[model samples]
Every structure is written in C-alpha cells, then in structure tokens.
Target: MKLLLDENLSWRMVNKLGVVFPEVVHVTSLNISQPASDISIWDFAKKNGYTIVSKDDDFEKIVLLRKAPPKLLFLKTYNLNTEKLVNLIIANNIKIKEFINSDENDIFEIFGE
Candidate 1:
C-alpha cells in the first residue's frame, strides 16, 4: 500500500523506507502547501490511495469523526531519533501490511517496543 508520511516525520524517510514500501512519500514532496492542514492531507491521501503515517493524534481524531478512505498508522512513541524511528517502522512492516489490507480497520497504532 502507498504511505504518505506526515509532516511530523522527516522527509528523508521516504528514500529510506522506499526499499520496503515502494510508494512511500513525505508530505513535503507533494504539491500541497507547506504546513498542510490535517484535513487537506487527509483529502490528498484519500484521493491518492495513501495510508497516512503520522505521530499526530489529529489524524486519529479525523478518522474517528469522518471515518476512513485514507487509513492511518499512528506512532505512539516519542523522542526517537530518525534511525530508531525508521527501524521501528521497518520491524513492524508485516503488521503494517496486515493493517493496510484489512477491510475492517482504518487505524493502526504502533508503539515502540
């Protein structure tokens, strides 16, 4: 599945994670305005078939309120360096795939182990 990384995440992650997630992209790479609104990002992802990867709770709130077209991968950990964060996501790749493929769920929460 395609993944649209949220602003809270580093744009550098696109290349790093691209090996496993070929369609991964950071929000900055898109044509949208810098500091895009959560709703705008959500709309973009919905239209483009991207599952949002974010550390922000705002996306979760949006999904709860509006339901999902663009799914969510919510990072519950904090204070992790880029490498650590990348590793966390990579290690959980299978779970991510499962979440993306599941028809019943829209949000997947990832906690640092």
Candidate 2:
C-alpha cells in the first residue's frame, strides 16, 4: 500500500526506506508545506488514494469516523530519530503490510518498543 507520511517525520526516514517502501512520500515533497489544515491533509489523502502514516492522533480519529481509503497508521511516541524509526518500520514491515492489506478500514497505532 502507498503511504502519505506526515511532515512530523523526517524526510530522511522516507529517503532511507525508499527501497523498502518504494511509494512512501512526505507531505513536504508534495509541496504541502504552506501550512494546510489537518482537514486539507485528509482531503488530499482521500483524493490521492494514500493512507495516512502520521504522528498525529487526529488522523486516527478521521479514519475512525470517515472509514475508507484514508486509512491511518498513527505513531504514538515522540523523540525517536530517523534511524531508529527506520529500523522500527523495517523490523515490522511484513507484519505491518500484512495487517494494512488485511484491513484498509482499520486504524493502527505503533509505539516504540
């Protein structure tokens, strides 16, 4: 599944995982750095068929309410650097993708562990 990563995540994380997740993209790269509201981001994700991979719980709430192509994966913890975050994703890729594909209507949370 394609992922629309939030600006809260470092761009380098997307760069490093480019090979692993070929379609991973950041909001900055989408030229959405002009401070659009969260609703705008949700609209963008909905129109683009991209699931929201964000550090924001609002996205999770949006998914819980709206329920569709705008699926969410909310990263709960803070203070993680790019490398650690990359490792966490890599370690969990298969299971994560399986779950993502298994249910696009579900909202998921990933905590640093």
Candidate 3:
C-alpha cells in the first residue's frame, strides 16, 4: 500500500520507512503547495491511492465524516523523536500491513509507549 506522510512528519522518514513501506512519501516531496491543507492532502491521496500516515486527529474526523477511499494510519502519540517514531511504525509493520489489506477498517492506530 502507498502511504502519504503528512507535513507534520519529517521528510526524512520517507527514506527510513522505505525498508518496509517501499511506497511511502512525504507531502513536501509532492508537487502540491507547501504546507498543504488537510482537505487537499485528503483529496490527493484519494485520487492517487495513497493511505495517509499522520499524527493528526483531523484525518480521523475527516474519515468519519467522508468515509474512506484513501485509508488512514493514525499515530497516537506525542513528543517522540523521529527515530523513535520511525521505530514505532517499523515495529508495527505487520499490523499495518493487515490494516491496509483489510476492507472492514479504514483507520488503523499505532500508539507509542
């Protein structure tokens, strides 16, 4: 599954997460406007088949309101360094895969401890 990393996340994560999520990309790398709006990113992901990866709760609210074409992976944590954040995602790789593949669920949350 393709993943669109939100601007809140570091662009460097695109390379770090590439080991497992080969199709991952950060918003800055795209042609879209700098500091893209959540709606714009949502629309872009829907059009391009990218599942959004973000720490923002706005996406969850959007998904609840609009339903999903572009799935969401919500990172439910705060104050984590990029390395730890990357590790959190990497550690939950299998669950993420299952989440992407499942049709019953559109939002998968990964909590950091």
Candidate 4:
C-alpha cells in the first residue's frame, strides 16, 4: 500500500525508509500549496490511493466521521528520536502491512517502544 506521510512528519523519513515503503510520499513534496491543511491532505490521499501515516488526532476524528479510501496509520510514538522512530517502524513493518491490507479496519496506531 502507498503511504502519504502527513505534514507533522518529516519528508526525510520518506528517503530514509524508501526501500520498505517504495510508494510513500510526503505532504511537503505534494504539488498542493505548502503547509497543507489536514482536510486537503485527507482529500489528496483519498484521491490518490494512499494510506496516511500521521500523528494528528484530527485525522482520527475524521476517520471516525468518514471511513476509509484513504486509510489512517496513527503514530502515537511520543518524543522519540528519528532513528528510534525508523527502527520502530522497521520492526513493526509486517504488522503495519497486515493492518493496511485488512478489510475491516481503517485505522492502525503505532506506539513507541
């Protein structure tokens, strides 16, 4: 599945994890205006077949309000360094993929180690 990293996430993470998530892209790289809003990102993801990877609770509310086409991966990892976050994702890659491929769920959260 394609991943659309939200504005809260660094675009560098895309380059760092490109091998694992080849289809990933970041909001900063999008053609849309810089500092795009959550709603605009959501709309973009929905239109582009991306599963959003974000830490925003606003997205959680959005998912609750309107289910998926753009799935949500909520990162609850608090205050982690970039390396730790990357490692955490690498470790949980399988579970993340499974969650994405699941038919019944639209949201998946990744908590820090």
List TM-score per model, in order.
Answer: 0.97, 0.87, 0.97, 0.95
For model 1, the stretches where C-alpha displacement exceeds 4 angstroms are: none
Clash pairs for candidate 2: none
Q: Could you give me the TM-score of model 2 versus the true structure?
A: 0.87
- Candidate 1 vs candidate 4, lDDT winner: 1
lDDT score at residue 88, model 4, on the 0-100 scale: 77
User: What's the lDDT of the predicted structure labeled candidate 2?
Assistant: 0.77
Better of 1 and 2 by TM-score: 1
Instruction: Write one digit per residue (lDDT tens) for candidate 4, span 3-61.
Output: 99898887778977677988989899898877898889999999988999988899999
Candidate 1 clashing pairs, residues 3+ apart or interchain: none
Candidate 2 lDDT over residue span 51-103, tens digit each: 77788887777777888667787877687888888887877778668767875
- Residues 32-75 of candidate 3 have per-residue lDDT tens digits of 88889999999999999999999999999999999998899999
Q: Which stretches of candidate 2 lie over 4 Å from their true place?
A: 31-33
Best of the two (3, 4) by lDDT: 3
Question: Candidate 4: minimum summed lDDT over ten consecutive residues — where?
Answer: 81-90
Taking the candidates one at a time, how many backbone clashes does each contain? 0, 0, 0, 0
Better of 3 and 4 by TM-score: 3
Q: Local distance difference test, per candidate?
A: 0.93, 0.77, 0.93, 0.87
* Global Cα RMSD, each model: 0.9, 1.8, 0.8, 1.0
